[model samples]
Structures are given as C-alpha cells and as structure tokens.
Target: MFAEFRKFVMRGNVLDLAVAVIIGAAFATITKSLTDDVIMPVVGWIFGGFDFSSYFIRLGPIPEGYTGSVNNYAALKEAGVPLLGYGAFVTTVINFLILAFIIFLIVRSVNRMLARFEHQKPEVPAAEPTDVVLLREIRDELRKRPAE
Candidate 1:
C-alpha cells in the first residue's frame, strides 16, 4: 500500500498538476499586479481619474455621527457595516480579461506555427508508383527465356 501510494504520488499527471498549479499561482500574481498597477490606473485616468478601488458602499447605522475614511476592508467590517465591495470585483474582472487576451494571443500564435510545420512535412511522397507491375514483367521475361 505504501509503494502504491508512492507510485501514485510520483505519477506524471500528479507532477504535471503540481507544476501547473505553481505556474498558475505565479501567473495570477503577475496578472494581479498588471491589472492593479498599470492597466487599471490607465483605465481610471481615461475615465476622469475614477478609481474603482475605492468604490464601496457602507450599509450600517452611523456611529455617533462619526465620519472618517475607511482605510481597509477589515475596518469597514469591524465597524459593523454591511459592505458592497465592487472595486475588488472590478479589478478581478480586468485581470481576467487581460489574462484571457494574453492566452488567446499565445494559442493563436502556436496554431499558426503548427500549421506551418505541418505544411512543411514533405507531402507523403505520392505512394512511390507501385513496383509490383515491374516485378511481374521481369518474371514473365525470365519464364520466356527458360522456354527459349
């Protein structure tokens, strides 16, 4: 049972999955940074500096007429506020779009490269004109020579 478990753990698919998970985590970080740091900022600038990161709604009773900017999401929750956190969602959506676009470009390029590679595979050489007929002709000539 231990050997079987070890074999299963060392299987090709398991290793492939582990590698994929690690790569996916790294890629997620890159996409998150790209969205939050570069792409979202440009998009926000285009939309009159409208920051989606700060767009949240506080749904609770105002505590003793206290008015202060909520810094973190934890603070809002700590203040007993029911919140609508759409900014993070918007950032996630943007990240997804960028990741999808990059993947599409990669797949498209790979397909084009594969098509060119297949086209260069030398055309199967057209079946080589069948040597059976020539063999039969030689056999008939030898038979006639024996008779002569």
Candidate 2:
C-alpha cells in the first residue's frame, strides 16, 4: 500500500499538478496585489478618489462598545457589525477577472506557439516495407528482360 501510494504520488501528472497548484497560488497572490495595490488605486483616482473598499451598507446598529469610526468599514466589521460589504466583493471579483484574463492570455500564447511549431515541422513520408521494395525490384528486373 505504501509503495502504491508512493507510485501514485510520483507520477508525472501528479507532480505536474502539485507544481501547478503552487504556482497558481503564487500567481493568485500577485493578481490580488495588482488588483488591490495598483488597479484599484488608479480606478479610485479616476472616480474622484472614491475608494471602493469603503462602500458598504450598514445592516445593523454599531456595537455600543465599538470605539472605531462609524465610517470605517473594516473597523466596523471587526467590531461585529452586520454590513453588506459590496466594495470588498467588487474588489474580489476584479481580482478574479484579472487572474482569469492572465491565464487566458497565457493559454492563447501557448496554443499559438504550438500551432506554429506544428506548421513548421517537416513531414517525412513513411518508408515502404522491405517486402514491398523487393517486389517492386523484382517487377522492374522482369520488365528489363527480353521477351521470350
């Protein structure tokens, strides 16, 4: 059973999947950072400095013991406020779109490269079998002989 488990884990596809998962996690982090740190900031600037992350609707009254500003979404949520955090949801959606777009571009480029490689490959004709070649040679020799 141990050997079987090792065999399964050592398979090329399994290893490749593991590596892909690790790289995918790293890529997701990069996409998240790009969305949160760069694109969101630019979008906020374009929209007159309106931060999307702060856009939420308060569903319940703030806790009496909460000392954070009422306008602060994160602080209010942390203090057990029931709020509809649509801004955070939007940010997450944007992150997903960015990651998906990047993956699509990568897949498209790899497909194009594969297509080019296939097009450039030289197609060699298959060689005839030894019996077929010998038969042809015999027919040629017979044709070359004088009529008897």
Candidate 3:
C-alpha cells in the first residue's frame, strides 16, 4: 500500500499537477494584488473614490450593544445584522473579469507564437538513401528488359 501510494505520488501527471497547483496559487496571489492594490485604487479614483467593499444594505435591526459604523459591512455582519452585500459582489466580479482578460491575452499571445514557429519550420523533404536509389534503378531496368 505504501509502495502504491509512492508510485501514485511519483507519477509524471501527479508531479505536473502539483507544480501547476503551486503556480496557480502564486498567480492568483499576484492577480489579487494587481486587482486590490493597483487597479481597484485607480478605478476608485476614476469613479470619484467610492469604496465598493463597504457598500451594503442592512436588512435586519442592529444588535443592541453594537457601536460599529452602520455603513461598515464587516461591522454589521459581526453585529449579526442581516445585510445584502452587492458592492462586495460587484468588486469580486470585476476582479474575475480582469483576471480572465489577462489570461485570455496570454493564451492568445502563446498561440500566435506557436503558429509563427510552425510557419517558420523548414519543409524540405528528406534525402533518399543511395542503396534504395540503386535498387530502384535495377528494378526499373529489369522491368524494361524482356524475360530470359
């Protein structure tokens, strides 16, 4: 059982999957940073500095001892207030779109590069061996001659 488990773990596909998972995790982190730190801030500025994360509608009455800001979604949730978090949802959708667009661009570029490489490949036919050529010539001569 131990040997079977080791074999499963050591397989080429398994190793490739593990590497892919690690790389995907790293890529997700980078994309998240790009969305949150760089793009979101610029977008916020362009849209007059509105924060999407804090945008929520409280559906239920606030708890009696709650002193947190009414506009804060996290605070309201902590206070056990039922709320609709559309702003957070919108932010997540935007992030997904950006990430998907970037990935599409990357795949497109890779495909184009692969196509170019294929186009540039040489199409010269392989040279026939001298022995095969001589044998063919003999065969042709025999065919041309009458039977003895």
Total clashing residue pairs per candidate? Answer: 0, 0, 0
| Greater-TM-score candidate between 1 and 2 | 2
Candidate 3 worst ten-residue window by lDDT? 46-55
List the candidates' TM-scores in order. Answer: 0.71, 0.91, 0.77
Error of 1 at 40 (Å): 1.1
Query: Highest lDDT among the candidates is held by which one?
Result: 2
For model 2, residues 50-115, the per-residue Cα lDDT tens digits are 687677899999988788899999899899999998888988999999999999999999999999
Model 2: which ten-residue window has the lowest total lDDT?
Answer: 44-53
RMSD, one per candidate, in order: 4.3, 1.5, 3.9
**Candidate 2 error regions (>4 Å):** none
TM-score of model number 3:
0.77
User: In order, what lDDT does every prediction score?
Assistant: 0.79, 0.92, 0.84
Q: The CA-based lDDT of model 2 is what? A: 0.92
Scored against the true structure, residue 64 in model 1 reaches a CA lDDT of: 62
* Cα lDDT for residue 38, candidate 3: 80
